[model samples]
Target: MKQTYGYQQKARQFFAVLLPIFITQLSLMATGFFNTIMAGHISQQDLAGVAVGVNLFLPFFGSVLGIISGLTPTISQLYGGGRQDKIGFIVKQGFYWAMALAFLFIAVGWLAVPRVLPLLNLEPKVHYITAHYLLAVSFGIVPIFLAGVLRNFIDAHGHTRLTMCITMTSVPVNIALNYVFMYGLFGVPAFGGIGAGIGSAIAFSLNLLLNVWVVTHIEPFKSYRIFHHFPRPQFSEWKKQLGVGIPIGSTMFCEQSIFGAVGLFMTVYGTVVVAAHQAAMNFTTIVYMVPLAVSMTLTILVGYEVGAKRFADAEQYIRLSRVLTMVFVGVLALLLTQFKTEIAALYTSSREVQPILTGFLVYAVFMQVSDSINAPLQGALRGYKDVHVTFLLAVLSFWVIGLPGGWMLANWTAVGPYGYWIGLVAGVLVGAVCLQIRMGQVQRKFSGQEG
Candidate 1:
């Protein structure tokens, strides 16, 4: 007889996995929150500079992170299938790939960002700050990628809390560094907005160190000997991971770069609009951690179950996660609606920016609801290793539909800045519908195979 899961049993397990991942995601998002808040307090120009800088960096970073993230599903499946011995060697290959990619990312950012920022015709001060910020943050790229590999390995083993503890511990350190570097405390010269990058670099380094400590010294993981017997780079292993990773990375790039593209486009709307846009984007992103946590957790669980050939259980996990995400996001929408003013206050004190920021938050409630549906479905599909089609879908939704539509509306219509967000809402809804259908097809295929 095949093992079965009850609703209550599934919910317990889901929360067990989801809570740690949620806390971990929150801790990670908090670092960005600190960066934004600190820069905002410095000055509107500083805040806007940080916004453009981060917008330039994150899409590329998201792509790199997405590629590295391929390790999680692969590792989860391997662990679930009882192929524990192959895990360490695989992670070694992932590390090699991460190092190579880190160098590539730093090179591209250094070479390309300066050349590109000038094309946007930003304020001279903002442009200078943006350039320096990316330069400073570049130092942390290698450690961030390496830490990503280890964190994925740990999370794949259902050890999310360990990574959470590691990340959470870094928060205070990140804040202290942010304060000192941003404000020039304790004899340190204030680099202003650029200091946010420096603080983040040091924090990323700290995270890497802590991840190394945990994997090397902790139970279960220590036995894997991930640090021992390092294997050389293999093209075949790279191909396997890249095969899954590239599409995922491409999809992430499309989705994230749209915002970056919008930020650049918003340059014409003036600095105040750009600052408000970033603030709104920042808060929505923090709220997004909830569904993102669900998505990530589903990826782990569904991948594990699929690897174990437990198709029914995998389906159950997907269904439960979607429902839970809906409920959570609904509550968040209420909070966003009720406390829009307070939330805006958290990001900036600018009277000019505050009302605009609050309006954007209203739009976020809709965007996030669609994202609740979109994120987890993608997570479930990734667990099934159904990535290529989703890549196409992402391009269609975010680029073919979202970006062009937003541009037209923003330029040709009355919506102005809000037009881009409306396009986001439409794009995500389309993606969600398409993904829902695609997920159904995958489930049927799996269910038939099981039958």
Candidate 2:
């Protein structure tokens, strides 16, 4: 009875933190879902264009988010240690890091968009629309980075409900703006696929504003005085964050860029393939949010336990997170496998795209289990500040092993796109195994056991 009660209490605590972060992440992801679905309505070319543009941008933007995510564990540790006074300093440093990354990405977008677009050899129409979309969305890069930093700070403190509310508010705003900008409603010029970019920029700007308001006015945040006095860049702190963050950022870049590379590679096969890939990727991404959220929650919970010097509790949280993630993903994979056709239809009305989408989901179902395992383990690793090994493994698994295998299988074999997906599965499985081993090493180290 005592053990059962303890497990129940832990489950409750886990969900209490997980649910809000999950909902917030879902709302954030909804922006992409809205963009993709609405773009699909315009034309298949538009859909492909939006898909390519978003994928191309993800490596840059996602890396920034991952880099700033280093702040979360740091903040959680400080919060857990009852060192609230130090939290403000860390957040101030995060802002500097965010702005630097934001500008760096914008510059990369300027140079790379022109050079990289031609390399893909995309369809002329798709290429033109994708370029415009990229240009427009580039405006939002700073706001997006700023929002990520704020969200990380809020989440680390376990004040996730406010972030959820702020992000959820953006969903409707984005959807409405997407409809207006995409269709040229309210006498606005129809930007077509580019409208999705415009809508996202506007929505992200609003998201930043709302987050700032909350952090400044909220009771929980007032004591931190994050905005009170701006501090100069502390080289020591910056070095510490970068040490932890760059590896994380690089790992994120590896994962997203490979997926983005897959999207680009599909363009060679033509629009139908690209559209099909987008539908499958978008749907799977939504499903992925479940494990992603659980992973983030694990980082916070474990970081708190570790900071408080409760190594056993941290280990327990990691175990519970892995079990919960696997179970949830297993159920989700089964459902997606069973209902893939019906689900594919939700993304587009085109008969051609639906069948291809359903086919892609077949691969997606198997990939989810590997993804579920890898994501939570990565999060648990983050809580331990064990980032470099994950980064090294990510490069080995995704770039060194996965990308080459995917390219060879996709271009050289009869399997076509299925081959690319198979490579992804293999890479994720390898990464999951590697990350789990690393996590176990950390656990042993913390327990003062020799490996």
Candidate 3:
């Protein structure tokens, strides 16, 4: 019983750490909102094109980020476990891995883009717009990779708020650039949909620049001389990071691959449903940041606790995290339910889009619980380095339960798009159950074995 308060103290400390991290996550969500609003201002076709462009590459981009993100937990563990010397070593490996990924994707993504887009069978106008948008957007990949190293390193050092501040600074700048580039404001060429991609590239570059600046000037990194400390990565330590990170990265790939599959599935459904689904998903993304941020914080907190050999403390932190995350998501679902039309209206001016989007809003409300439940357990499992189980489970639930079910309900039955979303509901429920079980078992193994 007394141990509970100890856990509470640890959780509160973790919460303090999370404030900036959550804000950083929220900044990312805000970027999506900004993109959605600006895209809507252009035209429905433009809006839909951008959505398709995003979905097409989302899995690959997610896999890259996941590969880099594996470092944050591993580095935190290195610190908490008192392997102070290995911190710089692991961070350098993360950067190298990110850099390598950046180069490989540039050649691969450019070639893949043409093949992937037409395969989706988009409307001509949307396809044309997406091709251009993707071109400009692709230029920012390496910069984003660089930013990941600095961002994750800072977060692992227990100073996440700095990244949030940099991201916050970038948001308005991105919006302004979108305005200038999209409409030829202030003597800039009006590239329209293509300009949106350029606008994004500009924003990403600034974010990378700012992250580097903070690393040099900020108290935490500056004091530590984080750059010099990592002049080179130790082979032994680098291998350890790859060992821990690769599986988690693949786990992320499994889930994102499913979304890519869904995007392909959406193609046969025609343009209107695809556009409406994009809008609804965009709005839902805003809600999703709530749990995503919370769960991400839980991962770091649990990782830190486990590292410090406070096994039970890690357990309590996740429980507290789940409770807090649920409260936020539940309230958000209620607000969206009450204001569905107003919410949908924010996406498109057309009456056609607004009505169909409302259906997606309804679905979003129900999906929040499952979404909230999934991230932390995934985080927890990653913390314990329990990769293979997480990977297999994600594949089974999303593909077998979600994708096939969505197909049967949508195509095989009369429900149409509802069938697909109903599949989403079932898949997430299964995901939540699987993740919960996995988290328990993971915690047990880590608690008993080493700590």
Top model number, lDDT: 1
Residues 110-145, model 3: lDDT tens digits? 898888888878899999989988888888888988
What residue runs in model 1 are displaced by over 4 Å at the alpha carbon?
1-4, 40-48, 122-126, 266-279, 333-359, 412-416
C-alpha lDDT score of every prediction, in listed order:
0.88, 0.84, 0.76
Task: Show pairs that collide, candidate 2.
Answer: none
The digit string of per-residue lDDT tens for model 2 on 339-397 reads 88889888889998888888899888878888889999998888888889989989988
Give lDDT tens digits, candidate 1, residues 1-451: 1234787887887887889889987777777777888999999889989988887788889898999888888988888788888899899999999899999999888889878999978999999899998999999999989999999999887788888898889887988897899999989999999998899899889999999999989988899998888887998999999888888899888887788777778879998999899888877777888888898888888888887888888998888987898898889888987899999999899999999999999999999989999999999999988899999999999898988898899999999989898988899999999999999999988885552
Of models 1 and 3, which has the larger lDDT? Answer: 1
Q: Candidate 1 at 228: error in angstroms?
A: 1.3
TM-scores for all candidates: the values are 0.90, 0.89, 0.87
* Pairs clashing within candidate 3: none
* TM-score, model 1 to reference: 0.90
TM-score of 2: 0.89
Name the Cα RMSD for model 1. Answer: 2.9
Best by TM-score, which number? 1
TM-score, cand. 3 = 0.87
